[model samples]
Target: MSEGVKWTVLGDDDYLEIANNGRKPVKASLRIAGDIPYYGANNVQDYVEGFTHDGEFVLIAEDGTKSVDNYSIQYAVGKFWANNHVHVIRGKSELNTKYLFYYLQTVSFIPFLSGGGRAKLTKGKLVEIPIAFPPIETQNTIVSILDSFEELSTELSTELLNRGKQNEYYRDLLLTFPEESIEV
Candidate 1:
């Protein structure tokens, strides 16, 4: 553990799994009328009719393309519906949720993962993963820095996506020469 940090297991903390509130929504089922985000292992698959959880929480991918390799972790606020493939965790007052979210991003789940191909992060194993708990002030400071970076990242991602669309449009425009103008 780092200086002034207390090492603890997540299970021993106030974190709880609230993955079930209703039947987990499938991708197809999500297309129906809904206002809530339907969370999956790594991302929001779609919007669904109701929410299983409200307020702020951190969601870790239990198993998916990104679980073993990318260690996909997301911070969600407001109402949302999480599938069984995600592990929901809410932080205690001592431990900031954003800080936990940032800390989990640094973790490599490769060693802790199960299943040969699809890699699952079982709750049994997940709970035992050690977390370095610093004072609330330190955690909050780190969260502030990380949250700024995340905001910037989101802006860049949007810009890149828009640029890609523009590139595609220009490519299509330049390539659409008149059929009669073709030589040979």
Candidate 2:
């Protein structure tokens, strides 16, 4: 947080709405295969039919995260099915959902997690996370900066992949002997 700047603390519960009611995990054997992404504590565990939610929301791992320092956090949009392992939430009122999504990436979930084998972020602990988000204007500016970086990274990666393919094509062309000059 920059000095003299206003930041919203997590203690203010009204800033966000914890919408975990839609979380319901089905057994793998009973799952109906489809195009909808089925979300777990980490990532998409599977693609199945029937969506549990149909809006923009943030998902934090409820349990099964191997490392507390690198707990799973995802920004999901549109239709999706979430299991019991993830806590679903969204910004309320004037808060920007994407802004919170970006701010959470910089947060360390270690203090909020519990459990022995698998780290768990309970609803109580989740709300207790010591996070301070900047005001909406600053948050939107930060989001814009991060999004630009992400877009540029994607472009560089695609260019590198295309360059590799081009190199392989030229390498083969340079190494091969002409068929017309080869003796049978």
Candidate 3:
């Protein structure tokens, strides 16, 4: 996508759901062909479904108990959903979702969230938020790299957990062996 292209907000597609308060909920099903990283507002609550976004996009929290200061939880695209609480964005051929997601992350757009009871993201401010899109290829490269890092991190975490369990098992086994010293 190029900067010259036109862009539109969630309202344009009728996807914008104005909440009673001033926030929206991130709720959408996403599906990526490859190792696309699926994300959610509170975290990975679910996996991608059939529909998938090819390009990059921005995800802003719309409604929730948590407070987001400037698009804190944003997701780049390989394939994912914005969910109900989040606003998914696309630049008219000019920008990809990844670029927008990254740009929003740098700022705190959620400051506008307001609602005594049920809060929601205001459509007016959301559309007005400025974003910059890098070249599509660049966005893809970045997402790919980031995905790799995320995968590695996840793997490491799992490995660490397994190690912890193994250590506990050995400790229990040694303790069961009556010969082991037991401090009074």
| TM-score of every prediction relative to native | 0.77, 0.83, 0.55
lDDT of 1 by residue, 1-184 (tens): 4459867776865543434344264667436668889888878888878777888888888888463556889889999888888888867778888888888888878877888878888888888777886888899998999889889999999999999999999999999999999999
Encode model 2's per-residue lDDT on 6-92: one tens digit a residue.
455454557877878889999999999999999998899999999999999989889986567777888899999999999888886
Model 2 per-residue lDDT at 21: 87
Best prediction by lDDT: 2
**Which structure among the candidates has the greatest TM-score?**
2
Q: Estimate, for each residue in 81-160, the C-alpha lDDT of model 3 and write its tens digit.
A: 34455555655444445555555567665555667675666667666554444556766777678768879999999999
Clashes of each: 0, 0, 31
Which parts of model 3 are misplaced by more than 4 Å?
1-59, 69-84, 117-119, 178-184
> Which 10 residues in a row give candidate 2 its minimum summed lDDT?
2-11
Candidate that beats the other on lDDT, 2 or 3, i.e. the better one: 2
Model 1 misplaced regions, further than 4 Å: 1-3, 14-27, 156-184
User: What lDDT does model 1 reach?
Assistant: 0.79
State how far residue 28 of model 1 sits from its true place (Å).
2.5
Clashing pairs in 2: none
